[model samples]
Target: MALGREYFEPSDGERAFAETGRSGRSRAVQLLLIAEQLSRRDGDELPTGLREDAEALGTPELRRDGSDALRGEQRARAVAGTRLRSYDAGLASELWSAARAESDPGAAIDLLGLSLEDPSPYARLSAILGLLSLAPPDGSTSGVDGYLLARLFDEQYRAPNATGGLARDLFDLLNGPPGGDVPRIGAVPPAPLGSGPLSIGVHGTFSRYGTSRVAPSHKFYGYLGEEFSPDLFPDETRFFRWSGRYSRHDRSKGARDLPLWLHSVGGVGELDTVYAHSHGGNVALSAAADGVRINFLVLLSVPPIERSLAEWAAIKQNVGYAMSLRSKLDWVILSDLVAGRTRGARDLLAAERSAGLDFPPEADVHTTAPLGWFSHSSWLDKRVWQSTTIEAEVRNKYLLTHPGSP
Candidate 1:
């Protein structure tokens, strides 16, 4: 242990020596990061080799106890709230940072004011049923209400595409003060306020949303949940279907059902978390050609829209490349999208390079992807991207690009 520390730890002067490729990444920092992840995670999730290393390194406990994990959260909430009550808005920031280092939602909410606690109305409703956590003793001190989140059509809510979810959560909280006169802020979408870019955003490939002219909860049998209206062309195009026949949504098997069901849908409010401008960028390009530079900023997971510019080929081929290549610049997070090491983070980067969008400084192009993607949200988790360490790299790069990320 001492030898490992000695070789890995760099003194002030040692860093200078290593700056010119004399040393690689610090082993000390690497080990510390691994140790932190292990500590942040449940013991059962620790890799076998990591478990052994942890034991050698003097971790107090290395066994999984489901009860202990739940108990810890409960106890921590109770203790921390009380212990840090007097600490102002910035309570032991370092301590919270270390504890929630691997927890993006935590940092985003408590540290940064965003939470996945009530990600969707359905999830929030389920959470109210004790499916997630017990209800708070009082409604006033309770977390943000799901219904209150519906109103983010306001312009002040945006914070670059990087902190999209965080900004949304803030709007929810703003709508629901401890006891506001409005009961709940009637958050009408910005659409009602105006006519242009600030009002609408686009995203896709979400869970099968059951909608009918009725209440939008009917399983939308026989029809796909994602309905796409091709630019001005009218047709009832479906993006999701169920079972052998279109069936009621069973959340348990939805991921598997995506490809089979995904037919088409306009990039509306669904992918708002990722793709915020120009659903698939086809319209943006078209709008751009007419001298209306659409502010396209994408942070999506699915492959780019295929054949987006092509008039209509049933299979929808080459649209992702077409939109990317045509754009002046595309800001993409390429980590999970590529296939291999030698290739880049985005599968389309090489193709874009061939088409001439790939630049060195990244200022010339309209479309740009960071080298990595953020991790934590199940939909945005790093594990989803098998290619590389996308979570950190992409987030940091975009963070650098986005000036307003409070």
Candidate 2:
């Protein structure tokens, strides 16, 4: 579901829903919360109210308003309580025991993994908290591991929009404040700049995909720099990887400030071209729309952006040229469409036949373009850049536009 929708925002329906303590995901979340409360203190017994809640949950029927709960409520309640007890006796107990006994990072990770995949949603949610408590500096996982866990949580739990859970809350813990655990890992510190026209490479998500050492965004930038080298001096073009906001909340505060960062980094009107992939395209588009002058904008396999063509036209007006390199075979777009986060999927799919009204009349759109063969992740692959047709297009569109370029 569109992560943009404010699930936690207050409303009458939400207030009423909270009172039940038995709403779908909400009930699961409560159980997790209670488990977290109990798990933190080494010797504390489960709270009386929480214990009763768990037992009552195990029992059966009721709409908190004294009306009959939804069908299957009793069954769900039983499942939640049973799962809670499993943690209380089995894996959760082992985790606490291991922690108190001595440092056993490996064991903790193993148990946490089991909890994460537990049959109960409540167990999964609570396991995340347990995992966080054991994270780096104090626990086994590194900063990179922490970041990956955060992404995993978002992808598995947040993406589904099940019961409007606490994905956002989890994100803050990782990325928030100085010394934040997740932000400390897999983070790409900004590269120092050089004096001259620059080829800024804007990266997409999965910043911490493999190891902390191999950042995909930075690697893509290096490849582009290698490709663009002969056309300009090494110092003339530089790559900048933009990961908007620490969290993925729509139009997050980080996104709001991106234009400022862009202007600050390259100086307004100084950047010669912008090469963006995936969600980074959104950041580039928003920056251009907000007044950063971009000469050439190349968007690769990004979802549909901009609410209207007029908005895109404004971006086009400021850029000397704009191109969208997309692939019809990339199931990533289809998956995003199903998830409801990307409208660009529609625009990209339509671009397969023609520009299909997603882009301005003058914009060049390439569908199933060889730039990225058949996958969303292929943009970083060398084979895509090796395509003769793709190489020729880049030369004509980008290098040819600049007098000194190859």
Q: How accurate locally, in lDDT, is each candidate?
A: 0.25, 0.42
All candidates: TM-score: 0.23, 0.44
The CA lDDT at 296 in model 1 is 26
Model 2 gets an lDDT of 0.42
What TM-score would you give candidate 1 relative to the actual structure?
0.23
Writing each residue's lDDT as its tens digit, candidate 2 over 1-406 gives 2222212221122231233333323323332333233223245443333334333333111111211222123223323343354433244445434532444333334444444544444335544544343322222334434443554456445444331233443344344443211221122233346545655656564431222111323455556666753222132132343433323332233334554554566543345766777666666665555555667777776665334566566566656667777653233332232222111122222322111113444445443344321245555544556643666676677754576854
The Cα error of candidate 1 at residue 22, in Å, is 35
Positional deviation of residue 111's Cα in model 2 after best superposition, in angstroms = 34
Q: Pick the candidate with the highest lDDT.
A: 2
